[model samples]
Target: MRIRYLLLDVDGVMTDGTLYFDENGREIKGFSIYDGHGIRLLQKARIGVGIISGRSSTVVAWRAKELGIEDVHQGSRDKEAAYEMIKAKHRLQDEAVAFIGDDLIDLTLLRRVGFSIAVASAVDAVKQEVDWVTKKKGGEGAVREVIDFILSAQASHTKTPFS
Candidate 1:
């Protein structure tokens, strides 16, 4: 199936799943420049990107804005509901959506999406459930790898400047 939309999980899929707290009890998350570029590539190819995270963080909002991703849903324990809402909002079919996740909470959406991806550092169960397991770990170019795979599959890169 052709994928029209891509959904990502922030903690484990975009970040290294590490939570850092400052002395003031503020959160700090590290995001990859490669992942940000990959998101831009997807947008250039007309594929929509969105984020659905179980935890709420201001850093997530900042990163999404930096990437120009408007569909951001944070603190969502029920990712499946968010997935359905995104699908409905975009009027996309089940077979037209791809999701990458890393934990047990992401299972339902992973099982339901057309293309299911798991980061290399993901838990065994998650790896076993995905259609593809990224060679690169999360927050370490895993998202870029997935983007290259999709662009290659769709031949979208043929028209991009990178080609």
Candidate 2:
């Protein structure tokens, strides 16, 4: 199956699952610059990117906007619904979509996607459902690892060697 789009989870998959609040009750989530650049590269290569997170945060919206990701679905308790919306919006089949998730909540989408991914620090159950497991943990270039694989695959399909 060919992958044309990537759907990612936030929290554990993007920010190491650590939630910090400042004295003023402001949420803080850290993201890796490596992952940010990877998303930019993927966009340049014409691969669609989307974020489907369970929680809603202003930081997530800002990040998605900065990355040029138009498909941002937060506060989605039923992620499958968000997934369906993206699929239909893109007119893409399930086999052409790849999803990276880290926990049980992600299991259902993982099972449905053609290429399912788990980060190095994902739970055992989530890892078992993944087609590829990244060597890097979330918020630490795991998203970049998957992007490289997809870009490499895309490059190879076009008969261009990636060094």
**What lDDT would each prediction earn against the true structure?**
0.90, 0.90
Candidate 1 per-residue C-alpha lDDT over 1-163 given as tens digits, one digit per residue, 9 for 90 to 100: 5678989999988999999999999999999999999999999989999999999999999999989999999999998788888988999888888888999999999999888899999999999988999999999999999998888967864532223
User: Looking at model 1, which ten-residue stretch has the lowest summed lDDT?
Assistant: 154-163
Per-model TM-score on C-alpha atoms: 0.94, 0.94
Q: Which tens-of-lDDT digit does each residue in 118-151 have in candidate 2?
A: 9999999999878989999999999999898888
After superposing candidate 1, which stretches have Cα over 4 Å from the reference? 156-163
- What is the number of backbone collisions in each predicted candidate, taken in the order shown? 0, 0
- Winning model by TM-score: 2
Which regions in candidate 2 have their CA more than 4 angstroms from the true location? 158-163
